[model samples]
Structure formats: C-alpha cells, structure tokens
Target: MDFFTAQDNARRKTGRLVVLLVLAVLALIVVTTLAIAVAFYLMGDQSTAQADLSAQGMLSALSIELVFGVAIGVLAVVVLGGLFKRSQLGRGGRAVAEALGGREINLNTRDADERRILNVVEEMAIASGTPVPSVYVLEEESINAFAAGYQTNDAVIGITRGTIRNLNRDELQGVVAHEFSHILHGDMRLNMRLISILHGILIIGFLGGMLLRSMRFRRVGGGGKRDNSGAIILALGAALMVIGYAGTFFGNLIKSAVSRQREYLADASAVQFTRNPEGIGNALVKIGSHTLGSHLQATQAAEFSHLFFGQGVRQGFSQIMATHPPVKERIKRVMPDWDGRFEATWPKQPDETDAPDSLDSDERSAAGHRFGSGAEPGTQAAVLTAASAQTAIGSMGQPDQRHLAQARATLGALPEQIRTAAHEPYAARALMHALLLSEDKATRKHQLEVLQQAAQPDVYQALMDYGPDVLKLDVALRLPLIELALPALRSLSMPQAQHFRICMERLIEADGQVSLFEWTLYQLLLNNLSEQGSGPSSLKLNDLQRECQMLLTVLAAAGQDDPDEISAALNAAESELPFSLTAIEDISDMRALSLAVERLRRLKPLHKPALLLAMARCIEHSGRILPAEAELFRAMSDILDCPMPPLLSEEA
Candidate 1:
C-alpha cells in the first residue's frame, strides 16, 4: 500500500484499539466493583452479609456508595495512565529511541561498522529520494533494528551492536532495507503511536506496583486508628495491582494483532528493494542459527518488541500474542526455494574486518553484480525522454533491485570531493551554500555579497571553493546532494540549526526572488529538521484548496512556456479537482509562492495523494516531462510521504 493507505490503516487500527481498550476498562470496572462489594460484605455483620449475598442484593450493592467510589478509581487510573504516557512521548520518536537507551551515532565516526552502516543508510536515503535519517546504535547483543519518527524526514534508524558485529555486508544491507521500508510505508508514524498508547495502557500496572509498595510499607496488625485504615488501603492496593497487570496483558494482545501483518509486508519490501532474497533470507537464517536469534538483551526490549527486525522477546501466549511470524515461515516467504534446514553461523571474529567477502561459486553464479549495477548504464546526459520520465513517476511505491544498484551508481556518479564533503558536517554546510550559487555571473556575484555579510566565514569559503564543480553537477544530482547533507545538518545544535536557518533565509531573500530550486531546497531542508515535526497540519482537504491552487499555479506556470500551454495544463489538472475557482493566473512572486507550498505541506496524508496526482497531470500536459520538472514532482512527493525512486536512464 502507498503511504496514504498505510496511514489510513493506522487510523483504523487506532479506532480498533480504542474499542478494545473500552472493553478492557469495562472489564476492569466490573472486577473492581465485584472486589469492593465482596470486601464490604465479608467484613460486615454476618446477618447483613448473608442478605447482601442475594442476587438482587448483589445488584443493589453495585450501585452503593462503595461501588461508585471503586468505579471512579478505575476510570481515573485508566485516564491518568493514558495521559501520562502520551505526555512522555509528546516529543516524538527521538524521545522514544532515547527512552530505549539508543545512543545516536556521530555523523563523523571512525569505527568501521559504524561507518559501513552510515554508508548503507546514505545510499538507501539517496536511492529512496528522501533525506538521510538520524541513526542510533543500541549497545545490545541482539540481531535487531527498528525505524522511528513522526514522519519521513525526521525518521531515525536504530540497530543493535550484535547486528553490526555478527552480520556480513549483504546481511546488514538487507536489515537496513527492511527498516527503510518502514520509513517509506508510513509504518514508523503508526509504530510511534502504538508505543505511546501501549505505554499508556501499561501505566495502570505501574501505578498498581506503586500501590503495592505502599501496602508493603503499611503496618496493619494493631487495633489502632492507623491500623484499621491500613487494612482498607491494603485491599485497594491489591485490587489495583490485579487490574493494572490485566491492562498490560490487554495492550500486548492489541499490539500483536496489529503488528504481525505489517512484518510480512516489510519482509516482502526488503526483498523487492534489494532484488536479492538471499540477503534478507540469509539474515533471518543467521538469526535462527546464532544464539541471539533476534532476541534483545536490553531491559527496554520487551516493551518495544513489535518494532524490532525480528521477535525481540519470546511470548507466552503462542502465536496469539507473538508480534512477528516464526523464523522459518518468514524466511520461506522471502525465499520460496529455500532449503527447510537452517545452518548455524559462527559470529565473526573480533579482529576480522567487514570488507566484502568472496561469494561461493553458486552464490556468485546466481547474480554477477554489485549494489548499484542492476541497471545497464544510463548515459551521463542531461535530457529526459517520455518513456524514462513516465516510468520514474509510476515507480513511486515500487523500488526494485535495479533501483538499488542505480542508487549506488547515482552516488558514485556525483563528484568524488562533493560526495566526500557530503559526509562531513562542516563541509556539508558549505555544500548547501554552493548548491544555491547561480550560473548567471551577476546573480552569482550578488549571492556572494550576501553570503559574505550573512554567512559564517568558513561556510562562505567552502561555498566559494566548491562553486565551479558544484555548478557542473547535474540537476538530477543536486537534490540528492542536498539530501546527503541531512545527517550532518541534523547534528547541528538547536541554536546552531536556528542560526543556519536564519542565514539560509537571508541568502534566499538576498537574490530578490525565489527560484523553484531554491524554494524546494529551503522547504526540504525545513522538513529534514527533526525539531520541526512535520509542522502543524489540518485534516480537512478542502481547507487547504487555496494552498493547493497556489502550488499548482506555480508548477503549471513554471512547467510550460506559452500562456496557452500554462492555461491548458491548469485546466487539465483542474478537470477532476473540485478546488477553489480562485486560481492564480500569474505565478511570479517567489516569496508568496514559497508560503503557499509551506501551507500545502500541512495537507493530511490522505489529502496529499490527490493533490500530487493532480499536479502530475498538470506537469504532463505537454505529453512530455523534463528532468527538472520530474525532480520537482519527486521532491514534492517525498515531502508528502510518497517516495518516488530515481528514474533509470539506461540501467546503472
């Protein structure tokens, strides 16, 4: 499913979860009321207790003062439990990862494993056409990983040390692909919501534990005033403990039911992404044979079990409460021709490096290729033909092994120094400035003056130094170049990031106009800032029609040359769209247009696909799409959570 459908499924699951939670709360209320009624009846006079035990008497007891008090307590516990958990997670996925003891990997790391994973993630990011995500390494001896974030750009990928130490390069690539699929399919957002809600549900148990502690501390033996009160307190604490533990059981059941189907989908996505079933299938096989078996040793593992690359913790309720499918079943799904037996894999030696290993004759004969070599080789030319452009547009949700190889090739094709600079935080900042430099001498001169006054001296120098080579870069490569800087840019301190943002704004405004490329770069950069949190959004599609009109107006105007061509494109795009009649005939004011696109970014996940489809129709009005126009659409799609893979010109 596309992001919209996946998001809608998540929405529906939220509703189902609410229904289940309601049933659980009702069950808790009934249990609490019964416990309270029995406590009062048994502790009261014998004659009165016998009378109260009758059926009608029991019904009457439920409406008594004590039952009402018990019912209120249950309501309070469930409400407070949910509210507290939501509050803890209000900061979003980064908070969730940190809570699980994930240490964010440095952008410039010396460790080979760390550097290898970073390179894999970067290539995946460029291939998938989104900003590189912040990566975290959990210091646990478990073969598992997870992706988390509020949206695509802010997403972070986390892996355990065990995975890095044990798996070969291809196995690591397969695991990372699985996580990237989660990022692309809107699963991360859904999973974050699941974590928050499950935590809320589990808090009832935590409160019960606190109450049990109070009971343990109290002295209830003496026939003193305090002793009598202690007896009642003990009963209440015992009741909460039972109910709270029950809530946790119910929450896991819900998590298991919702997460299992998605795991199968992600497994398929990984194979589809790498075009090598053996990579992921072998990884799973390794997990089965290795002692770890995707089992996490971290204290926080059990709580985030559903988010792992495999089952992090074994479940007691068999398949009913298992968050993932069994290992052999999952492996078989990916590699239909797999041998039923799993061979044990010895962990790599501590001294051994992760350099590419020699493949066996059979493995080598199966596919004689490398990561970005699936495609034959597209000419390193500037033009976009109709066949290639259309294929690229339609390849949004489906990226094959060829796409993976092409992605690696695309990065290789970029200038070596630029690619190297993209990896470092400081040079990355300069890379951004260099990308914004204009080809026109006067415009370039004017931008330099503004950069000198507003930008940091080192940043200005880096831009000036890289200017000529940057100018020679392909239009298709520029976005990916900007994307390459995301991880480093994310490493900026909040204050530093704010300063950077201000400087970029000054540079854009200094040009006295906003070009489409510049506006796209700024908006994309903003989205890539994890602090922004996808900005505030409205759910109603109709409310944002003016913003939609503004977006289409700009796209329509810039995409075509003649007035008739612009009008025809707009009309074609509008034919099915029930948008506002108030459309901009002249889309010249760059700042105003930038604001319009910003507003459009707030369109709900479901609302975005229609807008994108409409815009695509508008762009294709000439019966051909330029490479620049395709890039613009792809960028727009990426921001909206619809990932479009790079169009293959030849192959790789």
Candidate 2:
C-alpha cells in the first residue's frame, strides 16, 4: 500500500481500537456495579440481607440510578486518564523515549557504534525522504528498537545498546527500515493513541492499589458503627483492586490484537526496502538465540511494548498477549527458504571501524540507478518524465534500494568539513545563517553584520569560518545539508533556538524580499523545529477551492517564468482537480502560500493522493524537473506529510 492507503488504514485501526475500548469499559462497569451491589447486600442487617436475598435477585439491591452512576464513574476515570497521559506526551516521541530511560545520542559523537547507527539512520531518512529524526539509545541489553511520534516531523528512532552491539550494518539497517515503516505508515500516531488509551484503562487498577495502601494507614479497631464503616471501606478497596487488575488483562489483549498484523507488514516492508530478507531474518535469529532475547529491563517496558521492533516485554499470556509475531514465523515469512535453526552464533562480524561504507555487492547492482556515476554534485539533475512522476508518487513511503544508494551518494558528495560543521550544534546554527546570506555583496555584508550583532559570538565566528564553504555548496546538496543539520539544530536550548530564528529572519529580510530559496529554507526549518497540532484531516478539496488555487498559483509561478507557461501549468494542474485555478501575480508574499499549504496539509488521507498528483503535474509541465523545482516540490510534499524521495533524472 502507498502512504495514503497506509494512513487511512491506521485511521481505521484507531476506530477499531475505540470500539474495543468501549467494550472493555462496558464490561468493567457491569462487573463493578455487580460487585458493589453484593458488597452493599452483605453489609446490610443479617435478617434483612437474608430476606432481601430470598425476595429478590442479587441485582435488586442496586437501583437503576446506582448502576448508571457506577458506569459514569468508570467511564470518567478511563477517559480522563487517557486524556491526561496524552497531554503528558505532548512533546511526542522524545517524551516516550525519555520515559523509557533512553538517552539522546549526540550527532557529533565520535564513538564508532554511535556513528555507525547515525549513518544508517541518516541514509534511511534520506532514502525515505523524511527529516533526520533524533535517535536515542536505551541502556537495555535487549536487541530491540522502535520509532515513535504523532507524525514524521517530530518522530524519534530509539534502539537498545544491545541492538547496536549485536547486529551488523545490514541487519541494523533492516531493523531501522522496519521502524521507518512505522513512521511512514502512520503507525506512530496510532501507537501513541494506544499508549494513552491503555493508560486510561489501567488507571482503575492504579486507583485501586492506592486505595488499598491508604487503608493500611487507617485505624479500624473500634467495635461499633465505625468498625462497620471500616469493613465497607476494606471491601470496596478489594473489589476495585480486582476490577482494576481485570482491566490490565483486557488492555494487553487489546494491544496484542492491534499490533500483531502490523508487525508482519513491517517485516515484509523491511525486506522490500532492502531487498535482503536475511538482514532482518538474521537479526531476529540472533535475538532468538541470545539469552536476553528482546525483553527490555526497563520498568516501562510493558507500557510501550507494542512500539518495539520485537516484543519488548515478556508476555503474561504468551501469544494471546504478545505484541509481535513469533520470531521463527516472522523469519519464515521474510525468508521462506530459511534453514529453521536459530543459529547459535554467526562468524564474528567486522568491527565498526572496518565496516563497508556502502551496501553489499548484490544490493549495489540494482537495475535502475538513480544517478550517473560521472555526474557531479549541483550539476546532476533528475528528470520527471510523465512515467517518472507517477512512479515518484507511488514511491512515497516506499523507498527502495536505488533510493538508499542515492542517499549514500548524496551524503558522500558533501565536503568533509561541511559535513562536520552540519553535525555540531553551534556550527549548525552558523551554517544555517551562512546559507541564508545573500549573493549580492552589499546584502551579504548587511546580513553578516546582523548576525555579528545578534548571534552568539562563537556562532558568528563559526559563520565567518564556514561562510565561504556554505556559499560554495552544490544547490542539490544545500537541502540535504539542511537535513543533516536538523538533529544538531534540535539540540539547541530553547532560548538559543529562538535567538537563532530571530537572526535568520533578519538575514532573510536583509535581501529586501524572501526569495523562493529563502522561503523554502525558512518554512522547512521552522516546520521541523515546531510541533504541528494533530487534526481530524477530514477536509476535502471542495472545502478549500481558494486555498488550492493559491497553492497551485505559487507552485506554477515558482516553476515557470513565462506567463503563458504559468497559465498552462495552472490549467493542467486544475484539470486534475474538480475546479479551475488562477495564478496570483504577486506570489512574492509567500505568507499567503504558506497559509494555503497549511490548510491543504489537513487534506484527508485518500484525498491527498489526487492533490499530490495535481502538484506533480504542475511541476513537471515543462517536461523537465529542474533542481530548484525539485527542491520546491519536495518541500511541498514534506509539508503535506507525503515524503517524496529525490527525483532521479531520466538522463542518468
């Protein structure tokens, strides 16, 4: 399935989860109400209780109002608990990672293992055409990893130390690819929702335990009405404890039901991504053979179990509550010809220092190479032939081996010094400022002065040092450089990041107007730095005709210089839509386009495919996808949450 279909499926799964939660809560209410009725009946006078039991049914002691009250109370606890946990996770994947005691790895780490994993993650990010996510390393010895976020922009990749230590490059790459599938398929958002909803369900048990503990501190020795009240309190606490623990059992059952099939899909996607099933298959075999297996030692393991690449926690009910498929079965699905034995051990793998910088021989010989061997950075171009445009759309969220090779090539093309600068927090800030500097001498001088005065002294100096190299970077590499710098930029302190944004604004305005590149840089930068609010995504194209026109007008104006060509492109794109579009002459005011694109970002999942196709149609109208046009197109796709891999030139 493509990105849209996968997202739609995730939405449908969420609906199923809600239905299950309702059923679970309803069951809780019936049990709790019945328990309360029995407690009250038993607490009544001995003669009266006997008479009532004889005269009416067990439930007769409970009024309809009492049952309704119990249902409302249980529902309130569950819903409120879920909402509370959701709010607590407002920072998205980072919060989840931190909650599990995973430490964020510095992008500039010199540790060989850290660097290797970072390189793998960077390649995957570029291959999949998503921003480089912050990577966190758990202290656990278990071989497992996970991707978590409400959406792509704020997503984080986390793996245990054992994962990096045990798996070789290909195996690690396969594991990372599986996690990326979660990010691309919209599973992270669903996973977050599940975490929140399940927390609510488990709240009853937490409250019950707390009540039981509170009773331990209370004195209940007086033999009068007070003694009877103590008995009732103790009974209530015990009953709640039973009901609460039952909720835990049902919650895991819900998790297992929702997570199992997705693991199979992710495993298959991993194979499709690398075209090397043995990579992931071996990783799983290694996990099965290892004594620790994939079981996490973290206290929060069970709570976030479903988010794991493998089962992160020991299952209480085995397969019935297992969040992932059995390892041997998963291996068989990925490698149908597998030799079934969980290999006790494999030959010692190469150390990180001796690892190859590229994919294995077979993977490197993919049929359709994305770039020409002789083509240099900045000059290498990708064509968007009619066939290629459709291919690019289909490739969204489904990056292949060719795309991985292209990502490696792009990373290799960057100058060593520039790459280093991009990965350092202070230098990254300097590099971004340098990229914003104008070509015009006077404008550049003014921008430098603005930075010298407003930027941190060290950052200003770093800018001066890297300025020439940044100015000399390849046009195609410029965006990739920005992608590389994001993890470092995200490392900035809030106040420093705010200052960086202010300085960047001054530099962009120093040129008197926002150029297309400047707008792209600003939008892409800010979008990654900030959090986007989640919405229903129910809006259709018909709901925002004006906004759609504005977006197409901006894109047409950016890609075409001639008025006739602009008009033609707009009309072509509009043909794919239900309505006509008119070009805005003064497309200089990018804020209008930004607003329009923001509204379009909420386009329903299935509805997005057509809108994106319309966009591709407009950009490819000139019969060639220029580097700048390609950059703008990718930016638009990124904003819309439809990651478009780097366009491959037909000439290549």
Candidate 3:
C-alpha cells in the first residue's frame, strides 16, 4: 500500500478510537453517577429519619455528593488518558511476559523438520524489508504462533513446538508472514493501547477489593463490634467496587470486538503477502485436530488472548470474546471444499523419524544443470525469468513443483554466515565486515577498528560494501538485501547520532539517486528516530540560501533554470520557522543562523521546515524544479508561523 493511504487509514482509525473512548467514558460517568446518586438518596432518607434533619439540608448534601462524584469521574478519565499515552498497561503486560521467561528460545535446536521453520522465517523477513522478529518456542505441542510487541522494533514471534515439527517451510513462512503483516500495518500499537485502557478501567475494581479486605480485617479484629459509620463506609466501598468492575467488563467487550476485526484483516494480509492458502489452511486444520488445540499455559495468555494467533484461553465465555475467528471458518476462507483434518498423526513423544531431508537430491541435481532446456535457449531463459517472478507469491502462483524446487536450490548459493546473521544484529555486523574486506589484511583491520569504534561495526561495514553489492545483484537478490537491512538499520539511533544517519543516507544515494524502497526506509527511520530525541539539523534562512544557491548553480549548468522557482522554494522553507525569515535576513550572522536552525529542529514533524528544504532539493536535483515542487512548498508555507516573502509570491 502507498504510504499516504496507510497513514490516512491509521488516522481514520485513530479518530474512531477517540470517539469510542469518549463514549465509553461518558457511559462510565453515567453509570457511576447514577449509582452514587442512589446511594446518596438512600443515605439522606436514613439521616432525615434518624436525626430529624431537614429535607432541604439532606437534599443539599446529596447535591454536593453528586457533584463531587462527577468531578472524580472526570478526573479519573483524564488520568487514564495520561496513563494510556505513557503506555503503563503495555509496560505491565511486558513485565508479565518477561516474568514468564519467554524470551529464551533455542533457535538452533532442531529436529530435522523443525530446522526448516527457522530458515523460512529468515527468508520471508529478508524479502519483506522488515527485521526478523525474535522467535520463541513454546514447549507445548499445540499448533499455534503469536506476534507480540508495541511496534516493529520490539516485536517477537513465538510458536508452539508442534508448529515447527509439523509444518513445512512454506507453511511456516505463511504463518510468519501473517504475523509480520500485523507488525507492518500498525495493529500492534493499537493492541497495546487496548491493554492500557482496560488496565485503567480495572484499577477501581482492584482498589475496591483492597478496601473490602481491610473492612473484613477490622470487623474480625474488633470482634464484630464495628462503628456504624465504618459499616456505612464499607457499604459505599462495596457499591463503588461493583460498579467499577462493571466498567472493566464493558471495556474488555469493546476491546475484544475491535481486536477480532484486526485479526481478520491480519489473516487476509498474510494471504496477500504469501499468496499461499494451503499453508495457512493446513495450519488451522492441524490446530483443530491436535490434542492441545492451540491453548496457552501462561496465565497472562487470557489477558492477551485476543492478540494471539488463536484462542489462548479455554473458557467458554472466552470463545465468545475470542480475538480470532473460528478455525473452521478461517480454513474455509483459505481453502474451499477442504476436508478439515490433520493429515499428519500426532506422536506420543517428539518423533525424529518423520523429518524431511533439508536438501532434496533432485532439486540439487537440477541446480547443477544448464539454465536452458529444449525449445530454444532464449525461450527457456524467458520462461525461467517468469517462473522466478511468480515464486515470490509462493504456492499461489502457477509454477509447478519443479519451479518451487528450483527456487529452493538457489538458497544454497547464499553464504551460510549471511543466513545465520538474519536475526542477530551483532553477528550480522561481523559478517558484513568480513564480506567487505579485501585481500589487504592491514587495510581491513584498520577499517574494522573504525567500525568497532563507531559502535555499529556491522552496519558500517555493510554500508561500505552495499554500493558494490548493489551493482553485482540482479533485481531479485537486491530486493532481499534491502529487506534484510531494514531491521538492522532500525537498531541505530539516527536522530541522536546524526553522523551515522548521514553516512547511511549518503550510501543509499551513492548511485546518484534513491529508489522507492530507499525513500520509504529513510522516512521510516526518520519517524522512529525522531521519537527518541531532537532530530537532524533543521533548515534555516542561511542554510536554505546556501542550498538554494547550490541548486541554482546545478540548474544553471544544465542550461534550463528558473530563479523564480529557486527564490520561491527558499522563501517557502524559511517561512516554516517559528521566527521570521525576514528577521533572520536582517540579522545575517552566525548567532542568527544557529538560533533559526535550533528552532527549526525543535518544530514538530508537521511544522518542520527541513522537510520542505529536502523536498525542494529532491526536485532541483535533476537540474530543474518539477511542477509538484510548488504544491509541496505551498503546503509547508501554511504550516509555518513566519510570513512569506513578496519576491517569492505565487503571483510572481
């Protein structure tokens, strides 16, 4: 999907979520307010009868109590909003995940069949321009897998032992692709948000439980002779507690409804990415027939049941609240007229005999043979080219088994070290440096030291050699490398470490231009990095003037130039700063330049003028401004606080 389309979808969803939250808060207030009002009315009647209090005095107290309750409810929602933004609930869930010691997984420990699962995940991640998420193995023999994290960088993919042993490479790839889709499309963040909101709703219930326990302790300690006031306070606490619990239940229902739809979308996206139905279809069938049946043993699994690949909880009510669709329905969507059964029999113990050969002999034989067969070598080459393209879609393509076999054989040509480095950034860096090194040992050692000192030895080495590798690669090979590097590149602190990011950007543009993938990566990296710190140096009037002059020189050399376009671009960029562009021109000194740049750097992503300057640079890079540049310049002008110059006016 296009970036803007994806962004718009997220914005629309966010708007809906806001509305839902507001409605939920309003409902909560109404329910709690009514409960408190009832309690106040009852207490007022009792006070009037017991103490001969005036009706007016009792009514005034009840009115004050209602106002106080409403104020408290509003305060609670405001506090919850703050907590959601801070992601307190997600942090708590992660703590629970960590406490379960789920991070440790022996990826290298393999039964002959299980080893291929790792290989498939690596291949897909390399193809998709996403990091290979950390994979965990659940010892249970249930057929299931799950993706968890607040975002792509932190995401983890976990699978039951049964999935690895039973599924082939293609099936495993289908499942992983499905999980990766969730990571890519912003579902993980929403999932985390739901968890935090639910936690806030449940806090009142927990407090009520605490108060109830305290009251019981006091009554027991006092031999059941409690103060009448204490009894009244206890009743009030009990009522609040029950009402608070109702809020929690309502919140969970909403969370589950939203989660179920996201799960369906993720499933469809998985199919789209892999173009394989039977792979996921068979997986569902296996889960249905298996004895364990996709149930998780972890207690926290119930809380995050909706986030899993299948139902993690076994409760009947949980099935109604399930985040995922029924397995039968899921399988039907993927495979029409398919008999729902697990073809492979489950073993009482882990079986070694059923493992398939890692390398098929016939596939290897075909790999060693010539590229062409019969009917003219050129025609054979063309057919092979078409088959290779279709392999990207996996089993859904028209390619026969032989084509799949041929594609599998190509995997052997890649270095073992490169494959091993797929999920490990540190190891990936060492491998990259080794690949970059030439025959000169001394020069290589010096370069390695420089990389090591930079604290990104792997990425630095990879960047140094990527230019040469890009030239050597065909379209197929180049695509995988770009995908593989995305996760690794994300690990770096681009905003805080400006020099490192500059080096990366320079390398990506080394061939004198950036591709669509490179541009996407740049933007993604910038967005991620900007969250951590003050971003890259911002564009100021002096900086823009200098860049504009550089563009003018480049355009002039090409013999077709527009000074008006150049002036307009500079004016538009400078107008984005908080301070006036004209004011900076009046100062025209180092201090002014420094202050302007600093202010620009501090601007929010929407307001930043540097992006405008960058767009202008991109437009003028070909030695002339495109018509599109004017629209970008104008959009940026509207976001800036500063006024535009008359020389760069649209009429001009």
Candidate 4:
C-alpha cells in the first residue's frame, strides 16, 4: 500500500479495535453478572425453590449496586491494566527486549554476528532517512526476530541467536527489512496498543489464578464458616477462573484479526524494499526446516508473538487465533513458483562468503547520483529542496532497491575515524559534540569550554580533535552520520546519557541565540538520544487548526525571506490541511517555534502529512530551496517520523 492508504488503514483499524474492545468489555460484564447471580442462586436453592422468587426475580435480585459495582469494577480493572502495561512499555522498545531476555549489542561489537546485524540496521535506517535503531540479541537458538517501539527513534531490533548463526547475510537483510516494514507502516504503534489491551485482559486471569492458589490448604475449622463462606468463595473463584479465560479468548481473537494479515503485508513490503523476493523467501523456507523454526521459549513469547518474523509459538484452537499466517502461505506469497519444498537444514555458522549478491557497479553509481553521493564533490543532496515537493509523499515510508544500494555506498564512504568513533560510546558522544559545535571561531571556543565542563575530559578532547573532520562532512551526510552514532549513544549508562544531554543543551544554547542549524541538531539529539527514548505520547491532538497554525508559523518563518512569501507559503500548506489557517504570521522567535513543534508532535499520523506539506510550502517560498533550508525541513520531518526521499528536480 502507498503512504496515505497505509495511514488510512491504520486509522480505520484503530476505530475497529476500539469497537471490538467495547464489545469485549460488554461481554465481560454480562458474563460476570451472570456468574455472580448463579453463585447466589446456588446458595439459595433447595428449600425455597419457587416459593419466594422466580428465575427473573433471581436475576433481578442481582442488586443495582452489585451490578453497577461489577460493571464499574471490571471496566476500571481493564482500563487500569491497559494503562499500567502501556506505562511499563513506555520505557521504550528496550523494555520489550528486556522482557524477553534480549541483551543490547554494543556498537563497537567485534563479534561477527552482532556486527552484521548492526551494519544491516544502520544501512536500512540511513536509506529510509530515519535514526539508526538499537539492536538486541536474544540468546535463544530460534530463527526469529522482531522490531518493537511506539515509533522510529525509540525502535529496537531483537533477534534470536539461531537467526544470527543460521541465516546468511541476504536472508538476514530480508528479515530486518520485514521488521522495518512494521516500523515504517505505523504497525508498531498499533501493536503496542494491542499489547496493552491484551495485558489488561490478562489481569483477570492472573487474579483468578492467584485466588485459586490462595484457597489451597486452608483449615476446615468451623462448620458454619467453612460451609457457608467457603461455598461462596469457591463459587466466586470458579466463576472468576471461567471469566478470566474468556477474556483471554476474546483478546487473542482481537490480536489474531489485527496481526495475522499484517505479516503478509510486511513480507511483501520487504521484497519491495530490497527488490529480491529470494532474500525473504529463502529465509522463510529455512524457518520451515529448522528445528526451532521461529518458536521462542521465553515465558512472554505469547505476549509478543505477533511481533516476530514468524509464528513465535505453536498454534492452538485450529490456528484461528494464530498471530502470524502459516509459513507456507507467507513463502508462497513472495515466491509464486515455489514447489513447497522447505530447505532441509541451515548452516550452523553465519558465512560471509555466501552473502547474497549486492549492487553491481552500474547500480551503485546510479544510486549514488539519486542519493547525492555521485554528484559533484561537496554538492549536498536536495533531500527536501522544494518545500512543496518535499512535503508531498514520494516513497515516504517506502524505500525501494535503489535506497538499499545508496545505503551501502553511503556507509562505505564514511571516513575511517568517523566510522570508528560511531562504534564506541565516548567517541560517539564526542562526534555528537563536534556536530553541534559552532562554525564561528569565537562561538566554537565557548562551546568547547561548555563541553569540557559538562562531558568527560577524554570526550571533550576527542570532540575538539574531530572538529575539522566534522566540519568537512557534506550537509547530506550529517543526518546519516548522527544516525550511525545512535547505538553508541545508547551504550552509555543511564547516568552517562543524562550527562550527555545536559552537555548538549549547554553547548547549543550557550550562545544565547540558537541558530537554525543548531536548533535542528538539538532537536535530533533531544528526540533520539535522551535517557527516555522518543515514544508516542498518550495525548490525542485532533484540533489541527491551532497546531498547524503554530507549526506553519515556525516553518514559514524559518524558510521564507519575505513576509508576504511566508504568508503565502503558510496559506498553501494550510490549504492542504483538514483545517483552516486564517491568521498565519511570521514567527521568528526560536523558543516560540520550538514550543509549536513540541505541541504538534503529538498529532496522529493522519494529520502529520498536512503539517509536513505546509512546512515544505513555506521552505519553498523563495521558489527554490537552499541546502540549509532543505536540511532544516528534513530535520522537522525526521522529528515527526515522516521520511522524505532525496528531492530531485523532477520530483518538484
């Protein structure tokens, strides 16, 4: 699916999920109320059968207070359970990895398997114009991997040991691409919501299980207390057990309906991304033959089964509630000519010699031109050159084979020191410092002083040393350079990361006036490298007028030279939005602009494209975008997880 269609589907699915959740909650209330009334009926029975109360009267005897209490209690439990789970996951995708015993891989990792995955992840991130995501390795010897998080910046990739040891490089790339599909298509957000809701439903089962255990071995003392109270407790406990499992049943049903089809779509998207059906197709064939296949043994396997590359657990209930489509079905979709023979065995060790053929020289050179690498030396990419053209989606979340080739060349073009620095935490922090350093000699000296005071002495020295090289990097490479530094930034201890953020803030605002370039760099660091990784907020921002007006004002002011041009650009952008912007103004104050971006950040995916269009229009107000404007607009889009391809003249 295209960008808008994919976003539309996500929105519609959310509505469908809400409707389904409401139905599930109503089902719980009805079942719970009946169970309670049955307990009361059994308690009353033998002697006063029809003498006092009818059956309707018995259900009617279910008091209004008790009914309301049951309804409210169940609803509160579900809501609270969902909120608690969401909160726990809010710690970021790292929590998802930790939940299943996945260990974070270091950026400077020497281990071949670890290095390979990190490289693949980095290439994909750069190709898609996203921040490089952190990678984690699960110790289990199962051929499965998953991408998790609320959005792009905080996203993490998790894979099993078997996946590393068994799959060749091309197969691994296919698997990674599939996971990336989930991230780009807005699937992760939906998955997080599903996880929270299902976890909430699971609370009922857990509570019932605890009650059943609590009743074990209690003394059978007094006849009255044991007979009367024990009977009621027994009935209540049994009823809860039944209700809990029922909730689980519906929850899984919802997960199945929501999750199964997405797997197929991801598979197709992976092939589209890499332009090699065999890459992904062969991986699935191997999964079919491997002993572990994709089944994970983690206790929480069932919890995140939907997130995996394949079925992470054995199917039950006629495969009706399976989180992924069958392996055979998936492979056939990618390879229509397959004769259904699974690969008998996979290599025990990953082999570099057998990697899938990458781009040929012609393909590489062509990609270099499209990606700005093959252009004249020092000429930056026009990734967001036209404010208007860059704003409209080209392959917004979809990067084709050329992007893959470009990513490979891009990684290869990095200087040795920068590449090496990107692999270590302290050195990586130094690189970040250097990227934010001022070009003005006086300002640069002051920034260096702030870094020495706030960061480690060694890092401060390294930052100063890399100053020349960092300054020489082309504008187009800056985003990808910072993207490479992400995993290293993540490797720092929590305290260290916090200190880095403090150091960066001090360095950027130290001059008292934040330059547009400095602000963009600051936004990137703040959003991605913070102690709390960037995640979707719980707030819902639907009033697009106020938000778009504010955001467009900042964008308009940043990109346009003339006041009239700024107004015209803002008007053009808002015209595309689902809202009106009647009072567009030239907002030059950086603080006000930053606040506007922060406010607009919480908008759902459907509204963001409009804001993006407005920003592009504003930036192109001069009829053509300059390199500086292009980079700043790209940073704005990056913050919103809106990936913009390199802006070619023809794209306009």
Name the best candidate (by lDDT). Answer: 2
Clashing pairs in 4: 387-616
Q: Report the lDDT of model 2 for residue 340.
A: 85
- Candidate 4 regions off by >4 Å? 44-63, 219-234, 346-378, 381-392, 491-494, 530-588, 602-604, 617-626, 646-652
The local distance difference test score of model 1 is 0.74
Ranking the candidates on TM-score from highest down gives: 2, 1, 4, 3
Local accuracy by lDDT, each model = 0.74, 0.83, 0.50, 0.77
Which regions of candidate 1 deviate over 4 angstroms? 36-61, 64-76, 223-226, 356-383, 530-546, 571-583, 602-607, 650-652
Put down candidate 2 lDDT per residue, 431-502, tens digits, no spaces.
998888887898889888877888889999999999988787666677788888998988888899889899
Per-residue lDDT tens digits for candidate 1, residues 154-178, read 6889998888888777788889989
Model 1 steric clash pairs: 372-405, 375-651, 375-652, 376-651, 378-650
| Top-scoring candidate (TM-score) | 2
Q: For candidate 3, which ten residues in a row score worst on lDDT? A: 643-652
TM-score of each: 0.88, 0.93, 0.63, 0.86
- lDDT by residue for model 4 over 89-139, one digit each (tens)? 986788999999999987777787887788788888887777788999999
In candidate 2, what residue range of length 10 has the lowest lDDT sum?
A: 365-374
- Could you give candidate 3's per-residue lDDT for residues 1-652 as a string of tens digits? 4222332454456557667666766766665665565456545456453564455544444466676778586558646754854554343223334533454344454555446665665555443434445566666666777776664445667777777776666677678767766665556656666656666666656666777767765552243433344545566677778767776666667666677776666666667656777777777787787778888887567666666787777746666555677888888877888876655457345555346535565554553342222222112121222222112222221222333233343344333345445334444333333333333456545544555565454565554544243333222232234334334443445452465555445444344444333443344345333333334323344445443333223222222246554444444434333332321122223233333333443433333334444434434444433222322222222213111110111111
